[model samples]
Target: MRFVETRWDGYGFFLDPSAYLAELPRLRGVLPPGAWAFVSEPGHYDIPRADRCVKDLELAGIHPATDKSGRLVLEFAPNRFKHESGLRISYTGVRHLSIDYEHSIDWMAVDTVLLDEILPDEDGGCVHEIALTDARITVRCRDLEAVWGGGC
Candidate 1:
């Protein structure tokens, strides 16, 4: 499967459509009242700048407007993987809390697992760490294009 590298800032996860829909109620209970929710295909949109997209959605009356908290909770729309073939969800905000994996780690299992399996010296890539409320998540990947295959 072809997977694209993308960076998602804030709390994000991938879920099968039905599972995601079912989890909404519980998710709301934990998130701050004004927390934003986004559903999109991986690598299809810039997640960090999702506020702009959210504004567009709100203007179109597609979704309700939310406060400018700079933190968003995201889930992959159920059929996203079926359509895209490969899936990935980048995250930024859920730093300290123990992530609920049964609902969140359905599609991005490989990447999430890599967060723990890959080491800094294993690939000579940078290991990025995000301190969550209760734990620290580490991501070891080649940040530079040249490290993988890009320019001259």
Candidate 2:
């Protein structure tokens, strides 16, 4: 991953689709251990509960680049327990998107993030999952660009 510094945040970096997929294993390990409802057994959550970490990140917001066309972006901000860093994921050619939330998304602590290829090496189409404390987001898109936004 290339670390590119930004003005608002101390640092920021971009990752193309391939790089994002390659980093999934490492990103899964970076997230905190989800609730017992998630773990305690294999595939209890239906898909797969990703691994664990120390600090938890929270959902900050979701933005659309335009009204027409399938383009979207989701942002996860650090809880500040330890640091001030976050992640922003941009999706293009979004064939599908589902955001199921019991309540609002503001400050909702994220449990895990999963991005699986819809079909192995097929035009970058993927199913991106954002598992949060009170919500579950799934997006199927042709391409994904991720940005790591560091320290406030």
Each candidate's TM vs. the true structure?
0.19, 0.50
Question: Quick one: best TM-score, which candidate?
Answer: 2
lDDT tens digits, residue span 101-131, model 2: 6444344335333222222124435555554
- Number of backbone-clashing residue pairs for each candidate, in the order shown: 8, 0
- Global lDDT of each candidate: 0.25, 0.45
* Candidate 1 least-lDDT 10 residues: 54-63
Pairs in clash, predicted candidate 2: none
Query: What's the C-alpha lDDT at position 86 in model 1?
Result: 19
Candidate 1 residue lDDT tens string, 1-152:
01222223356522122333344455443332222122222222333332212111110001111543222222222222222221222323322222322233334323221111111223333333322222234433332110101110
As a whole number from 0 to 100, the lDDT of residue 52 in candidate 2 is: 22
